[model samples]
Target chain A: MPDNPQVVLKITDLVKSFDSTKVLKGINLTVGHREVTVIIGPSGCGKSTLLRCLNGLEPIDSGQIELNGQLITAPGTNWSAIRQKIGMVFQNYELFPHLNVIDNILLGPVKVQGRPRQEAIIDAQSWLDRVGLKDRALSFPRQLSGGQKQRVAIVRALCMSPQIMLFDEVTASLDPEMVREVLDVMLNLAKGGLTMLIVTHEMAFARAVADRIIFMDDGHIVETAQPEAFFNNPETERARRFLNIFQFQELERRRA
Target chain B: MFMKAAWLTVSLAFWGLILSLIIGFFCALVRFWRWPVVARLAGIYIELARNTPLMIQLFFLYYGLPRVGLLLEGRTCAIVGLAFLGGGYMAEAFRGGFSAISRSQIEAGLSIGLRRFQLLRYVIFPQAVAVALPAITATAIFLIKETSVFSIVALPDLMYVAKDLLKEGHNNESNLLLVLSYLLIILPVSLFFGRLEKRVRFAGFGD
Candidate 1:
């Protein structure tokens, strides 16, 4: 890691709960500019909840989240303004089915940001081309495959030019072959130095692209380390067990 | 006379539908916001309007309100009464539409920096309209039929004209014309809405 990379996102003792069940318990972390941080955890470990809290989609019970030194999670904060700096891609594509692909990409910039439609369309077209879906711009979401929908979703978020992007198991819902195409887009973004926080089960992709891997269990982060070290020599028993499950799956795949 | 009355009936149902849609939209928002007092109040309003008879509601508006120093013309009372009644059912249909939307869709809108109102207008409303279209069309058909109750208020609507014509000893012809007039007005309108419902059906995932 470069010395003293500028901190782009800061989280301090974040706590979130749904009624009596606590989901995130006092999480503390920071992401440097253009760094890729991947969060790996079992289901119901609050990984997705953490990403949701960053953008104020889920209100925090306590603690502060600062984006570019602006207090985002504070009461009376303008969440809409904060959201402009952050983008999120869900496990489900969540594309507006009524809209064609180009319209879906342009909706945020045109509707929310008040950009002129023609100008947004010009910009949105380039994003579509970048994802290799320029030909399908006028096609409705229902006309696309799972991979194509996820690609459009990523392009939609990118159209906002957000400073930080969050991916919540974005490929979890895709078919095995489709997952590769979606991961490729993320890989291309990582190479371009777009700051991202991802919650994913794809250990290999995490190892390949992550600057740091944060392992979460229950509601707490059990360990944070570089991907190479985390996979080869996990520090905590929880991390080891988590890796073993992946290792066993990998072994079964090889034998088959 | 019957032709004039049919036109009046159509006009009442049309205006009543517009008013009901507007009221139902806001009421659905109130429920969605989940504010304790207002949501409960909205809930009560829906229940009250839905459970009571439309004829009684019109009677209250036309006859009962004068006692409270709020008198409206018979025509206005019928329109308002039908609107109030239809709004209750429309609110439920809209609420169902709103609920059918996946939580992630709203989250996606929020994450993309859409303000609450913008999110509802652009992303949420379009998808919801698709989900709720059939219900709304059903409500429209019911409201059109419910306008017959306006005759009780002596609004000179189709049914009122039929009743007057029957009482004046023009019995068989008036009854046959009344039924045919209703079919003529309602069948086309219902068919139009049914086609519209099909047109707006969402083509997205999880439909």
Candidate 2:
């Protein structure tokens, strides 16, 4: 049976290499409508590479990425169209440091989506409130804290009305106290049923929100399982070892 | 006696700064375009103008260029010298501003489907101006001081009027009046520009 047109996104055998090293060997995944899938891995495990490749930020050596039933990596693909449908939030926040928060949110819809400025601004205002930064619309990125900046980044992506959102360790740069605020925004995003693919180190967030957890290691998908089963009874040795590190840290925190 | 020369100096400095800024803007754009030959040529010209004395540069434009059939009036030569000197330094200042902007910002602009020129004008230029404003103000001050060199070209600038007043028996009083004249002109303009710079900066255009 063919997948639904609203299936959101699919990637098949995505391969990417940098110089002599292969960052993403081959990856395949599907994101369903209104589902949240979080990819978890150790550092340098190609999780971020996979997210970047899916969004066309990093060109894949070979693969088929389909968003809204449109082939994104096919020959002569309309990349602008692909990007407009798929939004990405980077770990570093990547909020245009020069633009005010409101301007940043409106930039994509007005400029790329060709919406009127007034319409875009109104939409941006609502999205800013949704992300909990309505009062910060006039502030510069440097003026905002890490959490606020991350919220603005999310709103910036959301304003594009992307059917699928990809986040590459979105809270990785936040302070311990600030991390929760940013993740709280992501939780709200999840509650809204945004189709999302997230590469994250935040295990609590993965367990709490992800419908599916994909564990990647050495440029390969080591395992894909529901968050509860994967955390409770991981099958792959790589997944076991990765979970061991986090579990040990959690145990130490509890003992303390 | 120094009042007339002070008026002349103020006018020359004001107009010379404007001319220099116009030339600087284009030179900065040419540098920003990163045309290898053109960029190198701009670099050479700036170095030549900056390393040499402003007075000598003014004299060369006023007197020496005439020998090669490129004669211009003394005042015109002064403006040319100031513009060339300003263009050279401002080009580098602009290049610095360009480098300071993050690559992601440019990519973000492109991802939004902004054409190359639109990207530069709307995104690149506005942000670069915020970064370049300080250097621009500094260059303007340098250009103002440079207008004093026009006296060597026999232009009746402030310094020229002051010298003439002293020679015509106004003595120490001319020196005091000249100093006061410079204070009136440069102080207000610099303060106004400085305030404008702060406002633009406070408006929070960054990236």
Candidate number of the best TM-score: 1
Ten residues in sequence with the least summed lDDT for candidate 1 chain B: B198-207
TM-score of each: 0.95, 0.85
- lDDT per prediction? 0.90, 0.80
Clash pairs, candidate 1, are: none
Residue A76, model 1: lDDT of: 95
Most accurate candidate by lDDT: 1
DockQ, candidate 1, comes to: 0.67
Q: Which DockQ values do the candidates obtain, in the order shown?
A: 0.67, 0.29
Number of clashes recorded per candidate: 0, 4
The most accurate candidate by DockQ is: 1
Estimate, for each residue in B1-207, the C-alpha lDDT of model 1 and write its tens digit.
Answer: 878999999999999999999888888888987988998999999999899999999989988999999989998998899889999999999999899888878888888888988888988888788888889989988999999889888888899989988899999999999889988988998899877777776454445
Across A1-256, the per-residue lDDT of candidate 1 in tens digits comes to 5334689999999999999999999999999998999999999999999999999888899998989888887679988878878988989999988888888888889888889999999898888888889899889888899999999999999999999999999999999999999999999999999999999999999999899999999999999999899989999999999999989999999999
- For model 1 the interface RMSD, in Å, equals 2.0
